[model samples]
Target chain A: MNNMEKIQELRHFLARYDLPQDRPPLTLGHPQADAVLGGGLRPGVLHEVFAGNWSAGGFAVALAILAAGTKPLFWVRPDYEAMEYGAVSPNGLLELGGDPRRLIVVRTRNAADALSASADILGCPHAGAVLLEIGGMPKCLNLVAGRRLAFAANESGVTVVMLREGAQAEPSAALTRWQVSSAPSRADDDDWGNPVFDAALVRHRAGGLGHFLMQWNPEHAVFTTHPGAVVAAPAHRPAYPQERRAV
Target chain B: MPRLPTDRLIRRNGAPSKAPLVVSGKSGNALHVHALEARAARLGLYKGQPLANARAMVQPLAIVPADEKADAALLEAIADWCDRFTPLVSLDAPDGLFLDITGAAHLFGGEAAMLAHVTGLIAKQGFAVRGAIAGTSLAAHALARFAPAIVPAGGEAAAIAPLPITALECDDKTLRALRHAGLKTVGMVAERLHSELSERLGKSFVTRLRVMLGAEEQPLTPRRALPDLMAERHFAEPVVTQDAIAAALLGLAQALSEILEREGRGARLLEAVFFRADGKVERIAIKTGEPLRDPKIIMRLLNQKLDALADPLDPGFGFDLVRLEALLAEETRPATISFDHDENARRQIGFLVDRLSVRFGYTRVQRFVPQDTHIPEAASAAVPAQDRDFGPETWTLKRCPDDPPRRPLRLLQKPENIEAGFPLAPDGPPKFFRWRQCQHDVARAEGPERVAMEWWRNPGLTRDYFRVETKAGQRFWIYRDGLHVQDQLAPRWYLQGVFA
Candidate 1:
């Protein structure tokens, strides 16, 4: 057969085996980020949102995207994460536009239970999305577990976000991997202005990657693009001195 | 309807043997026979006889302690198993079951065939029982225990006429009184004048006599509520495969849905029972958030429940009958023909929650419900998300978006202790605080919102909270546990929450 005919035949074969078309992407509401992601982050697939520094910025960004959906969300974390790193604050989450009433917090004894719960939550169509916060990726969440999570998420058409802390981007079955760190707010007065995050599209299954500075506007209830700064060699270090140390 | 009675169920729970066995228990100071096997009874060994006397009369008699709990549990399990024959099964106390198979006997061919089937099933399970069918439970019970025969329709009086006076289940005093009066058999009692019997034996004897003769009706109280709606199918051949079970469930669901639709009602709770040929019954229950009459949704929920069961639903020796029952129902009106996409979407969400809760335990899924208390920790509670009433009433906040929220989004379930420097003023916020060894210098402070403890509810020290923003732009809600009025008592500060 000619090259064009062979190519056409291959395309049809790929189409037959492609992921289910029922689940579409959930737009992050950030233009630049969405552009980098081709269109938007695909729902019904596992995605990792990690922070080089274990700050609240990464979780804030996750909550911003989660707030756009009308259905309830499940946030599964290890019980120790709550005891040691402080629990989620209802006021803080409310300020971030995440309705605390619509959020279900599941605290498991260990990472394995959290991941299992995450998979369970993903399979629940009632849950618009699920955010799993793990201290780090353990050996138990290997490719097999990832595939199981992916399959469950896809079947239910629910977005699954894994909030990883102090972990490197490891090889797994996740569709996209992001690195978020706290960035300097634009306001000068000490009123705790809008929250900003230096976000990087570290990995993408469909392939284009980029970095951007995103600001969460509580007034507008959306994430707006900020002027990107020249990131340091480590990729997530604070841009200015004042932003370096936040407790 | 048939009723089966046993003197003692203990002998049936443990190992079965043909040898004469007697279960002994201590009555006051004397050890007496609590129950006996059929062979023991044939050998003239009776219950309530002193163990010493029984042993003296019959050497090498098998004796075991009576366990009433175990016997009762076995009886309950058997009653559950009897659900295959009829859903209306009730315990007759001690060791008896009243099964109201009024409309169900024909499913197994006929009443006679169903009785034979039950006796064979119970016998195979190593339980020796005598079952009888009569118009009334009193006659059925009397025939079951005394003669172990079926009393034909309208033959209640004839059935008990030959039974001994002891079959009346009266006290020994009453029996002695009856024997003294020359009434040894029910026939003699039935032949007595009603006025004479009442004057001589008291009103109670007359009542018992009338009940035994079917002149007075006694009702049977079932263990479970009679289902609001039920649909069942009896397989000609036993169905063992998962596909067959699924198909049977779908058929039953369809049948049940039609009934529900016709009644203008919908089911909220449904139970599916798999009655195995070996007399084992396995049941799965599913709950829905809203009234549902769709067979497809019911089937899908059941499928999820069956898959998620910890103990696989084993159709032991294959199931002969499958039944679907709507345990709870609600009045439902036909939906208005509209193009409201949001309603459909919300319905789908509710279905998803129900399905998820079934798979991963209902308690594992939860929703935050706002409570009345002002205490930050007690302001909201996590209740099961699948709770039917988890709606806007418990979650919607009264404050508008423009109004500043008095509470934080995330309040620590337990306030973490933090070391804070003494403020410049008695009610001012701390200048610096150290939490988890990380120091934060407060650059701006909001207020000293003094909240007093509710006096009626274990009143304690009042708290002064402040919304403090650190130099790095992170806001934390810190509170001083006690007031600063006492010089000797220095209030300790704790970080209670954080703001975005």
Candidate 2:
């Protein structure tokens, strides 16, 4: 009976040092998508986003903004990536409902430098997430390197998003793998409207696969399924409309 | 040694010639002997003798052209090695050095012992060495050439009296004039009237003589600025293992941290110097974002730099001395335990930025600052994070809420030319376009948003921009140059960026 009491006391002491297991995941606000992802995108793990075309880079940026919340986001990219896929414009990020001031960019000389920088950034629990963009299958980003990155993220509770462009899918330690491409705008809607993407979940370690036609609402900062998913809150409708105006 | 050019050549080649070797250089229209080996000097090949004449004097002679660049580099390196002894070491070009050991003499014993120790160590490296300590640099320069003797204070006049006038190291013309005047020694020149000597030579020459005799002091300009604080270790036997070097660094860092803690300050720029046993020195330096005093942090930064070096540190013949110096020390605010999570997180992020900057570069780790300009590319600027003067100005996005992003998610370094046809409706976006070897039919378009260039700063034609989405849903931002009638040229279109 005395030993049991001591064991209980030790367990209480160790709980403070361990990571908080009750931290809620980030919800994308789309009911169906949230249900498939087991509530939302989990933190403290690695995720991979494969760009089906050049336009898919936008999908990766949107995900990062959602995961980062009010914290800072660190982006690491190689030197050649800027020339090939263009530079990340902070002005554009602001239009996508992200605070440009919260972004930090680390431009590395090569893929190896980018990997090393990502590891260092992930070790800091203060950082919200890291976006690492690599164009090709560099030898430095093999399975071992991926595992190391995953370990760092899990240890610090900093989400990592690896955006791969122009490369084949390889084995990785990511919790979820996605293939993203831009989708045609709805014909009846306004020509100039929010961005839409056809995202397919090819691999999920904890759940099943899914294909989503998600539309990003910049004003509300949430994703909405187009066509026949659900009736969204009207932009013109005031809140508590059923209550009559006293004036 | 006076024959540094010849010595440097022999040491680098690693093999000596069977015949005597000499370094030659062009003097006027003829080749003259710059320096020669000991054997050549003994065979009566004096410097300044014509190379042609030396060949006739000695049947077997090996001659090499003088390389003053390599010789100067070697002299500079030797001066770097001497830095371990004292911080104040100056270059005496061609073949000599000036070491001002005023208060440093007692550290290596007395004046005489220090001189003996220095000359002995240099001699072991296969080079002839001579050193002396005096009250002034000029007095010591004259004494070192004559012999390795330490002159007593206030006895310079009597001690330099018997030395030849060549000890002054004056121009050849002055030496010739003195020789012709029947004054071969310094004492004979000192006996003459000051006015008479001044009238013959110049006021500067008289000053030189006075300084050499200890009547005045000539200051020596040191090679580097003195460090704010320093710690060093000298090994009795050369140390070659990595563990030993690391242990030495750890001890030195601890010593430095204790010193810094007492003063309530930290170092911003730290330098580590390694002195090899064979007269080679390597200096590695690191810069921090904030004043840092922790020994562990300093060790980690140094380890990162050493690992990333392109050419790894070479411990040839092992290292005899290692030194850690704080080049720039600054007062730091005492760190208080933070109760707020956000503040603690910010501090930790600042440290991460410093480490990344050291690995890549300061310019590579950057944060975006809003620029007060309307030009697309000039709207925002990326500056090094360490600079930390970010203005409170926020990015003013152009698009309205709930509308598509008018700006592109990613912008090319510069606009690229594209092939497109004129729209059916005038002053509108192109109907069809070809880009990157793919043809796209425009399904929707928005714009003709006219943007004028900054006429006063960089005058150019105005551009009409359009946001177009293809049938495949890929969006592009394209702009047409000024009207063909106004610019008197063909209307051209360019792809500026891509929208997500």
Candidate 3:
């Protein structure tokens, strides 16, 4: 009957239609390391990767992640020199199907801003995956502000990967943490041969410590086990009765 | 009494009231009508006498000065106070205010109540006030100044009937014409036919008269409409420190986030308003790189921006109210978490880089993106620090014709000139070279890679680049500028960039 009444009626009608739901998280598989993850990477969760001495292994893993799909990936490299290690040698990543359009690389100035931004990207629903390079060893990142990112990722379903350069004593809230090291190459004549890598799944929420030797095939852009590659000794191997010593 | 520009008329008790004469005297020539309560009062200096004649009547009459600016400022304050009732309030020149309280009346419990409330408030503030409700601002203004202080709805005509012809607020010339036409009371002129009156007085007379009679509607322009989303916090105890302001900011940001999340949208721009105890408002704003609804992230960004303000947060007395508003918003999809360990790690790293870049300069942090161009320098661009692209795989290692035979380890920001002579062919490196106050002999040489500048651009310069290795095993990327024609000057050599 009146303008107010009309507006009220319209508002009630609009209230009935629900808002559009968010897009499902995008899945990505390391072409050379499918078996390493069982399937492909899940859309939403925090994953940690430890790089020991060999920086090239970390580069290869980063390349593998980028080449996995067309989804846009954000790469945040805090250390300037470390970025050169990945971009200078074009062997592993250049050969993979890494699209520049889908990648964003950022160099942060300080640790605090870097950490905060890492959390922000995890909270963003539209981001396919965010790659952050933490120069030092892993620290307690589960502060009040830090936990917001985990909650955001869980709520919005965006995957976040924290790459810590050195070793740490304590564990983080990451769903999975894997230590990656470079293994000897197995190729004889091919210029673009497969590079074998030792990936130790130190911690996993799914309950098992999955330590397996994987080979990264540059040509196939996938990860598989090499026949002759040696796997590291299991962490939980029971100490032999003779080897056990009293503290 | 004679009219004086600098004097005001006040009752003996300083109270405003309706009277026949209340003019104040200004100049010595001003005619003061009367005086009371003194020896000058015994001199028959009545209040209505002309000032000049009053001087002649009594030389000792007390005279008080008037301040026009003070009066104007006082009127403006009253207008500002009127804003509480309706945002559409404007000055009506000299001494009146026009407020459009149409739809706003309901908020104050109807027109009569709102009018009574405003009048009561002004009266309590020690000011004489009058107000009227009419269809048009001009009509209400005329009614308030000339007719009674209150007019019932639909009584505009009857209320205006008894008022003098001056109630029209016409110019002196028009009033004189109306007086000459024997039209004294507004009711007499209104009683005549509209066309007849217009023919007698002028077209404007009929128009103003019609507006006064509710025949036309006048629109009111408001200052600003209420924002789409608003969050406010009032402190129990006023806050005067930056820390307190920041804490308030956090609360506002959190509240705003909830509202934004419910709508499944994010704000691109946000503004925080700090309302001080003394009624002054301080505002701070921030623009996000992307639409975001996360309260903590927004608070961080806003904190950075606030820290950049030149004025220190001196709340003076203190800030009693803080309001946060999302000025611009966009629809956003929900974010997802990563399950893969490596992927999740990468996401976290990306976030870290973005935050660092915001604090530092984006240019300081960058990603190397391979370009499709054939020129060596054009092969890649340094992308700003953030999540962008790793670049196309096809162009990552594609060798360009303009690439040096042996790329230098580093590329200087700009080329430095060098003097050298080539012992080999034009495409070969120099046998001897001098650059940066140093001279070296080339034991080995590499072929030159010609790179032509973009001719379409202004001041384009072409150069033939070469990678030369000296006897000491030092590699340098050198270029010869200009063409090597027979008559042209010898090519100028300069170093640009190096390769590892």
Query: Which candidate tops lDDT?
Result: 2
What candidate 2 keeps of the native contacts, as a fraction, is 0.77
Off by over 4 Å in 2: A1-22, A186-190, A228-247, B12-18, B152-225, B389-393, B449-461, B482-489
Judge candidate 3 at residue B54 and give its lDDT. 62
- DockQ of each two-chain model: 0.31, 0.53, 0.07
Candidates in descending DockQ order: 2, 1, 3
lDDT of 2 by residue, A1-247 (tens): 6999999988988654333333578898777667777888878778899898876788888888888888888889999999989888989888887778888899999999999999999998988889999988999999889878878888888988999999777878777777887777766554566788877766666665567778887777788887623233332232223211311
lDDT tens digits by residue: candidate 3, B250-293: 88888999999999888866777776765456767655545678
Q: Write the per-residue lDDT of candidate 1 for residues B192-255, one digit (tens) a residue.
A: 8989888977898888888888888878898887889999999889999999999999999999
Candidates in order, TM-scores: namely: 0.81, 0.87, 0.45
> Clashing pairs in model 2?
none
Candidate 3 CAPRI category: incorrect
RMSD of 1: 5.7
lDDT of 1: 0.73
* List of chain B TM-scores, one per candidate: 0.86, 0.86, 0.54
Candidate 1 has a DockQ of 0.31
RMSD of 3: 16.2
